[model samples]
Target: MKTYETLVAEALTVVPEILPWDLQSRLEQAPAPLLLDVREPEEYAAMHIPGSLHAPRGILEAAAQWGFEETLPELVRARDSEVVVICRSGRRSALAGRTLVEMGFKQVQSLKMGVRGWNDDGGALEDADGNEVDPELADEYFRARVRPEQMGP
Candidate 1:
């Protein structure tokens, strides 16, 4: 078995490093991180980090063929690129980031605190393809999907 750091180091050639606020700043400033959201489809639909790409955790599990296969060209292309992942919290992205690194992606990082953290810090929301969503409907969409009881205990 590999140590946690060892596992993390395995795939990452040049690991990405940016907390939620820093990431938000990166998005606003010069170069932006390719924000990857690894949540479920429903979760992503309800809310997600602005400019984030959705490549759910299950898909990420098959990192090798996810991008290379013509059937999933967009996802595959993303796999080959640098990305920073976000989930509800940060654990899943950390694991996924390591997996992405292992799959030969040069850079991957987990956003600290995920989408929840981003929203807390006043980051904007966007659709899966990185387009702005209707602000009026955004809260309704989120409330319908991500209720307190819906979250796991």
Candidate 2:
């Protein structure tokens, strides 16, 4: 049986991942990739990469398509644009990137290490209001909180 880890691994195989620095460089280029943050709203409100568009994973498919109430016109139009899917630690983004690929997106990639990695790499992060988030505080937010029940049996 495939576990969550296996699913993320499988998704990475089909969805290329971009390192934080590389992604930053790409963003500086003429045509920047659309940064899609798939994390929940609360998580995003706390901190996120600047310019990232929020599209929670729960309704990602609907948000990506046209004619749905949840439809994000930017996402729908980005089907032919370079898209970078992001999440807390990269796992969710990889899964979302795979979905974008299947949804006929021309170019889809996951952010390697996600917002956590970016913060670790000295990248700037912003709150939903566009205020700069303190790196140290962001570190605290991104810290792994594995539960006992989630550990190896």
The number of the candidate with the highest TM-score is: 2
lDDT of 2 by residue, 7-122 (tens): 99999999999999999889999789899999999999999899988999999999999999999999999999999999998999999999999999989999999999999999
Worst 10 residues of 1 by lDDT: 63-72
**How would you encode candidate 1's per-residue C-alpha lDDT over 1-153 as one tens digit per residue?**
787667545434345545778886667765566777889998897778766667788877554364333234444566556578888766667778777776777667888767766766667887756677665555455343567987769
Question: How does candidate 2 score on lDDT?
Answer: 0.94
Clashing pairs in model 2? none
